[model samples]
Target: MAGTGRAGVWAVGSAAVAVGLIVALAVRERTAAPTDARPLVVYAAASLRPAFTRIATEYEAETGQRVELRFGASEEMLTRVRLPSAVDPGDLFAPADESYVTSADKLGLVAESRPVARMRAVLLLAPGRMPPTAWGDLASRDMRVSLANEAAAIGRLTRQRLIATGLWRELEPRVRGAATVTDSANAAKLGAVDAAIVWDAVARQYPDQRTAELPELTGIEAEVRVAVLRQSARPADAERFLRFVLDPEHGLRHFRDLGFRVVE
Candidate 1:
């Protein structure tokens, strides 16, 4: 009887030890760092590269998630997102203007959009050139003016402003078009053109160049917008990233630091 009781106690002790070990292992596994962190893909306008890159870095550090960024002109990015392809589409699309987001939403490409920042078209002047005070000055025959190609958001805004002010027909002949806003700004910086119509942020990039506010461009600010794509495999992650970007302390601060105007 005594031997049997001792054997039963040993058995019980062994079983308890085994159960404790199993529970400990389970807890450790639960607390262990995740091995498979899915990456979030983002398609953004080229003009947003600097600020977005910084925000991506900060997000990755804080969330332990990865970010893949694709940068191009806003219209070009939109076209890429709309392309029918076998490969997976990006998780998010951030365009330089709100119209692109609205078009994407209409096409069922975007699930939702939020305005993140704002910018305005301005005249960037070559070194030693006097700033133009009015829209009519851009139509001067002697002035060699650089303008963004129609594909860029800045280009569309510039054309709209010119048309609204009745200067498009008169200034169209003097305009030299470039592929991107950066190129247009560079044309002025390199003295290839007397002036360029570019975003205020782009003009800020070349401190040596001068920026002039065209009275006609008033109230024509570009509203930068970010959207979660309908085809995104990870919509939650995309929304999280969008929230991070719109966060006043995190992403908007980066935008402001990079000379971008954050939308209030």
Candidate 2:
């Protein structure tokens, strides 16, 4: 009887030890499991590349969070976010024009949006040439100009303004089409054209690039608006980044330095 009692005690002790080991192993595994640490993805317009890149770098430094930037035309960014099967959806979208945000919101892709900056069209002139004082000056026979095609946000805005002012018919014949505002600027820079119409901020990117603003091109401005996608895997983190972007001392300063007018 004594031997049987001792064996029972040992069995119970061993069982308890085995259970404890199992529990400890479970706790260890739980603690050791990897976290979801994927970098936040952002789809932004190409024109916003410079300022947004700086903003993202500052944001990453301050928060220690990674950002993946994908830059393209505003419309292209919107299309990608809208079609996840075709392209991986991004956490946020920063288009050069606010209309893209509105379209995203209509498609139920955007959770929220905020205005960042404003840009307007300007005439980028080649070196050693006089700046055109007015829109009519572009109508001169000797003046060859490059313009962004309708696909780019800047191009669409420029075309809309010219059509509204009844200058499209007169200007279209003299204009050579470029795929983007940067390309239009480059056309002028390379002397492929006498002048190119591009965003005011883009013109500032080129040092010694003479630019002339035509007062007649009123309402040709585009607002850079950022949208947080509803499908973001980390909505809270995305919102945090959005707040940082709107902070006057943070992202706004970068835009201002790049010649973009702060929206606020």
Candidate 3:
């Protein structure tokens, strides 16, 4: 009877130890870093693709975090941010101009925003084409000019410049509209149009493209801005990525290399 009682006692002790071990393993598994973490999603302006791509590559190398990029016109990107659902929520938004960021902020879509770089509009001419001396030159009947559509940030800026210089009405009839600033640049590159009003950085992107300064548009700069979205499921990671992009040696360097001026 004594031997049977001792065996029963030992059995109970072994079972408790096994249960404790199983509980500890379960807890550790729950707390451990996921082996396949979801990539951070970034929604950026089309014009920023080159710089952002390089920056994202560097960021992934440094942090071992994957980055998924979605590029489009700034206005379109803003619209996406305003309508994020569970299936399509984004982590960050980097628009071509500050006005869009401000608009997003006003709508409670942006948690925080920081200025990243600056760009100015310029006239991009096709190979062997003479640079236009002024905006009026683009209004010539012989000139085929492309401008971004009204829904794009660059489009709004270009229209505002034309209106402020009293050239919108005259130029409107002659101008063809592209969906984005990059598209405007491509129009000139592909000879679909003789020239385009595009951001300076985009003009530099194509070696065959020549730039003509628009003096009337002087001092009119687009302030590139990045913002953390209120809809981000991982705000900490998003903020960290934002800081990485703003770092002088990391993302800002790429922007500078791409012909963007640092916003002071």
- What is every candidate's alpha-carbon RMSD to the true fold? 14.6, 13.4, 12.4
Model 1, residue 47: what's the lDDT? 75
By TM-score, how accurate is candidate 1?
A: 0.80
Pairs that collide in candidate 3 are none
Instruction: Spell out the clash pairs found in candidate 1.
Output: none
lDDT of 2: 0.85
Residues 17-96 of candidate 2: C-alpha lDDT, one tens digit per residue: 99999999999976654245667789988878888899999998999898888898877888899876423457999987
Sorted by TM-score, highest first, which candidate order results?
2, 1, 3
Taking all chains together, each candidate's TM-score versus the true structure is 0.80, 0.80, 0.79
Off by over 4 Å in 1: 1-35, 84-87, 139-141
Give lDDT tens digits, candidate 1, residues 1-264: 366798888888999999999999988976653437647889988878998899999999999898988898777888988983546578999987787898889899988888877788888999999997676666553788898877677788778877987878888888999988889888898899999888787788888878898777676677888899988888988999999999999999998898888875
| lDDT for each candidate structure | 0.84, 0.85, 0.85
**In model 2, which regions exceed 4 Å deviation?**
1-36, 85-89
lDDT of 3 at 97: 75
Greater TM-score among 2 and 3 belongs to: 2
In model 2, the Cα lDDT at residue 33 comes to 44
The residue pairs that clash in candidate 2, if any, are: none
lDDT of 3: 0.85
